[model samples]
Target: MDPKSVRYISECFVQPQYAPEESKQPFYLSPWDLAMFSVHYIQKGLLFTKPPPADEQENFIGGLLDRLKSSLSLTLVHFYPLSGRLSTRKEENPPTYLVFVDCNNSPGAKFIHAALDMTVSDILSPTYVPVVVQSFFDHDRALNHDGHTRPLLSIQVTELIDGVFIGCSLNHAIGDGTSFWNFFKAWSEIFQAHGNEACISQPPVHKRWFPDGYGPIINLPFTHQDEFVIRYEAPQLIERIFHFTSESIAKIKARANSEYNTKKISSFQSLSALVWRSITRVRRLPPETTTSCRLAINNRSRMEPPLSPDYFGNAIQTVRGIATAGELQEHDLGWAAWKLHEAVLNHTDKKVRGFVDEWLQSPFIYQLGQFFDPLSVMMGSSPRFNKYGNEFGLGKAVALRSGYANKFDGKVSSYPGREGGGSIDLEVCLPEASMHALESDGEFMASVSSSN
Candidate 1:
């Protein structure tokens, strides 16, 4: 189908069904949230076969849209902060900006109804991700900072001839992958129960996590937008989803462990090591060139006084495992996985506290493209997230896809496979040539059971 085939039907702000008086106060952003102020918005989407046909197709679509929008409103009651916009106040002395969620105004989240003339196979069976899929999202080239004016969360429900795609554009400053999926799960629960609040088993915790002595509002050094150098322009690349079956992942983990003579190698670490090595080799960088794999680690349970699993905000840190290209290429998969395992193990509670302390002392924001080197890989989004568990009445999601928000060469997003049982689907973005080379590499293709 043509990329422009997606047509918008309706758009509006989806407010909470009932906003508590406490939600009227400005929601303070934590240091973790402020650090991601300039990063790209988190864009994720789910695909499901169309609900059982109705007498009139247009009426069916209308009914589906109403159900989604209404359930979203009820979900927002618990996630009220998502309905708010980012607010900022500038101080002159040192040229600082105080950023927080303006919950008082509650601008509300954006809900869009769109239609696409395509089949489920057109998306699930594609060799490379369809460019038109990017159009499903609300904000194409937006950053989290755009939340100041735009909705902190935007949901676009695109009706397909044979399927439906529910896309979300969430401000990264407000939450991470964990928080994003939790909100989605809650919405799906409400929608599945025909908009019943009793369906929600565990409500999300809206209280933001902050280090002691730190604040609900964090200050940034930048006085003007020009001072921030975040660019959404990504290098030309091809994106593909590689799926590893449960058995394949087990084989990979066993191989890594056997090679390293240890049983501690995890499935994720092994998988990460394989991708890192393959990408580095495909790039064919200099032997001495330094290549790193940055892993986004969740700090909820790692904190001294561990934060709740339901904490609804950014609580992640990107920890990097470094090695030279020569070393990585020469070493076995077990060696590389061990390095990543060590990196993850080493991020102890003390280290988490140290990072918070350092950030509190000298607050600095992350600039887009600075998180990974040109030859590095950044693995984000966890396979542990229950992607397929979101059954919005029709059935479970058949496929998971991401958008053009924070994409870059070597950026990988992991999702739980549709078949589950410890399987993983990695959405890999890489330059055209590098992607071509990766597809031909036998060592990498061996672990990948399928790709699209």
Candidate 2:
């Protein structure tokens, strides 16, 4: 059966086993957190094959969900923010508002058990990502700000015919990809420990990071919800995961370095250049038209004092490498890669602070087309995340997939290949016609491996 024909078995809230006394106070969202209010939740999931036997499948699923819920409850003891909801305060002078997470009366994270009549191959075998994959996640259209009324964290464990898909929708306002994965790893650790919380190597540092003289509570200029709550309707596009082997990435990096006469060109820069150039060539835009590749930088280590790696909440800034369509097509891959390298290297601590200062001076929400226009690309979700290391006792995940939230033209998500060893999977989203063109482009397809 189609994946959309999913049957939801049960829904329940899994609260923390022990709520700390400090959690009674509202958790103030920093400027970094507020900046993500308009963005969608981080919808990522893992795929696993080899489910229990058909005869014992019902009991197996029930026991699995119960264990997951119990482990999640234990995990939330430290990640209590996930159980909180967004709250607002009406400020009078200057007519603005304040947003914070009211952690006092915790509603807990939503745990949903669902089943779909599909196999693991139904998802991994497709050239283009299946549209029905969106159904595996809860809060399909929710923004990070929706945490006010909706659950901040929602997980859907969907049982397939021969596999299981663990899909999670975490409000972006609460954290970034780093925090999301940290929470996931910790939860899996607790689960694998069989309720032994001592297995957690390092508890997350929930203390939010803030620059000196900045704030624990940031104020926004929007007086009305409509001014900040903008809906994102993605354009007609197709998403395809292009797998690049470790050897291919090295070759691309080598080619870029050879042309540039420098070994400083990183693999990521080379890959970004290749895609940017390839897409520009296929688009055939006017000579003077400008194209950009927006790269999201993790600011944890980039800060002056350096934030804790486990510091929960958003600490990211986007840097764009802009070039004319003709310039990209006319120049060599090394040239484009150099442009991206300069952009990344120049985003120092001063630049990161400058970005926050500028945003603070004039607060605004990010729209879907804000940085990722049809002619521009936005690269997010790094390949360095522990995609396959997440072991839930069922063995490593077969694949990593994301949901429909925040997907737009020119949006590209990077993941580590299943085989690891520096391999990468680029989940590229482009307009239907452009995707067709990309598939037929031999030069681009040459680096992509046959297997995903």
Candidate 3:
């Protein structure tokens, strides 16, 4: 009855429907790519699915998997970076050689066909998704640029008696959330169209670029596989989704605006502020503890000259809100919200431009290494991306999941719910004790409409 108890039926590689005209070519990965070496594939992976009607049977999974594989096959031709492999640039020079995607050697992405005897409801009903979200992965060198074995993208489709589950993992060195959803929208477009269209929703841009005065690529600090993964330390953390209704958000927004005596306060600022304060209180950290909240800012629009909307690569820069535990817990939601609002506003064009320049000089390492800190939380994944866009003729996704990698402590992902209503889902991953306190915190729970 549990999804984790699901059994594997078969596994195979699903290469591009047609190999690229260009082979044996290596695409450059910028300094931003190297900075992400530690963060790796975990945050890049997500689980997608649709609810099953009562009449659907288990055997239908086979046919559905075929459709997924075929659709992905066609999709990979356009999203070739996903089907490629990472090749290390063994050079010691700046802009280290470890930063590139080698398309010549690797075959297509890995696709697995699996089955779960349990119904979808059994797994979907939990407040926190179980460990099964990490199961059925193709662990063959997926984290590094070592060989031709790892696919930049690996997918698994697990068949449940009631419905199907799709797990997709993308290599961070080659792409980010923007790239993932962009590809997804296009994939669903062509798949739903039954391959009748010649052009994809948007052609991908694979070329990596740098500002005129920037030079010398930044290399990752660690070269070894075991050491590389160490940067992302995992703790015994559980995840839960807190759904805030439109009314709740509106109320928070008003309060946040009133706190600053400014009539303008965005929904994201208010909600994120509340989360920062609530978590700070629940943890009951020392008054003098240094606390911070990091916003996942996209460089696409923030760049001197904005990148193409279709720019396909990692283009995010994190800006943090600094505070003391005493400051956070003592403030009203509006106070916390204003802190977040000002932190983001503090980024100037000169500062945003300096991001890459500074990274190349002394690369900005991913914070996953410091994720265990008791006084910080990295707020990421904007609700702007249409998470519910890809219908694929199977109805919109009932929900989308970041899977397990993001379950690391101090990670929080916020997204709009599939329902068009102004509701938001704040997926928080914290230790069991902290989660228990958060679950019972009345002020926090008062704003939450549901947790599932």
Any runs in candidate 1 off by more than 4 Å, and if so which?
1-4, 52-57
How does residue 452 of candidate 2 score in lDDT? 39
> What is the lDDT for 402 in model 1?
89
> By lDDT, highest first, what's the ranking?
1, 2, 3
For candidate 1, give the lDDT: 0.88
Q: Of the candidates shown, which would achieve the greatest lDDT relative to the real structure?
A: 1
Q: How many steric overlaps does candidate 2 have?
A: 0
> How good is model 3 by TM-score?
0.90
- For model 1, how does the per-residue alpha-carbon lDDT over 1-452 read when each residue is reduced to its tens digit? 56448999889999999987868888888888888877888999999887666434667777778898899999998988999998889999988788888876756999999988888898778789988899899988888888888999999999888888999999999999999999999999999899897788668888877777767767777788667747658899889999999999999999999989999989999999999999999999999999999899999988878988899999999887899999998899999999999999998889988998898888887877776667899999999998888877668888999889888889999999999999999999988889999999999998899988
TM-scores for candidates 1 onward, in order: 0.97, 0.97, 0.90
Cα lDDT, all candidates: 0.88, 0.87, 0.71
lDDT, model 1, position 346: 91
lDDT of 2 by residue, 1-452 (tens): 55457888889998989988767898988788888888899999999876446446557777878899999999988899998889999877788699988877657899999988888898889788888789899998898888999999999999888888999999999999999999999999999999998788768888887767877878788787888788888998888999999999999999999999999989999999999888888888998999998888899898888888888888887888999999998889999999999999998999988887888889877766564688887889999988788877678899999999889988899999999999999999999999989888887999888643
